[model samples]
Target: MDKAARKAILRELREQERARWWATLGLTSAQLDALHEHILANLIDCCSGELELSEQWANQVGVDWSRLEQALMELGGYCDCEVEANVCPD
Candidate 1:
């Protein structure tokens, strides 16, 4: 395949993988983006060493806290800062 074709194929595969990853956590790309932004903004103060900020954002956005927390924990996001560091889009 040509270089452009290869790049496009890789991009498509990445999109598919991202979709599957977010789907497993019951979150859409937009939701993840919002969550990332929210956590990032809050982390400016300090990481409460917990998911307090994440849970607040999830509650505001009407996402299931339990499910999201479970997924985050599985991905090594045991805290708000960890979530920003670990659970983010590429």
Candidate 2:
């Protein structure tokens, strides 16, 4: 695809992400704070090579892990092994 097309696609994706972030903002303060802590703990565990602990944290949070992971990524938290590379492989 051409540069303009690529740019348009990226912009659309970013807009969708922004919408998702806004949805998270609609959550109650308590819920939001809990989620932030859960995400933070998960990220820390993952970075420390504690995959099992990360999974446990997700389970304790009682949220869909996939959705929580996506939210964490959008919020600028890194968990993947490639975090130092600044690249998160899906």
> Which one is best on TM-score?
1
Candidate 2 error regions (>4 Å)? 1-27, 36-55, 80-90
lDDT of 2 at 57: 56
lDDT of 1 by residue, 1-90 (tens): 899999999999999988876977789888999998998876755687889999999899999999999998887788888888844332
Task: Provide TM-scores for the models.
Answer: 0.75, 0.37
After best superposition, candidate 1 residue 28: deviation in angstroms? 1.9
Instruction: Evaluate residue 23 in candidate 2 and report its C-alpha lDDT on the 0 to 100 scale.
Output: 78
Alpha-carbon error at 49 in model 1, in Å?
2.4
Clashing residue pairs for model 2: none
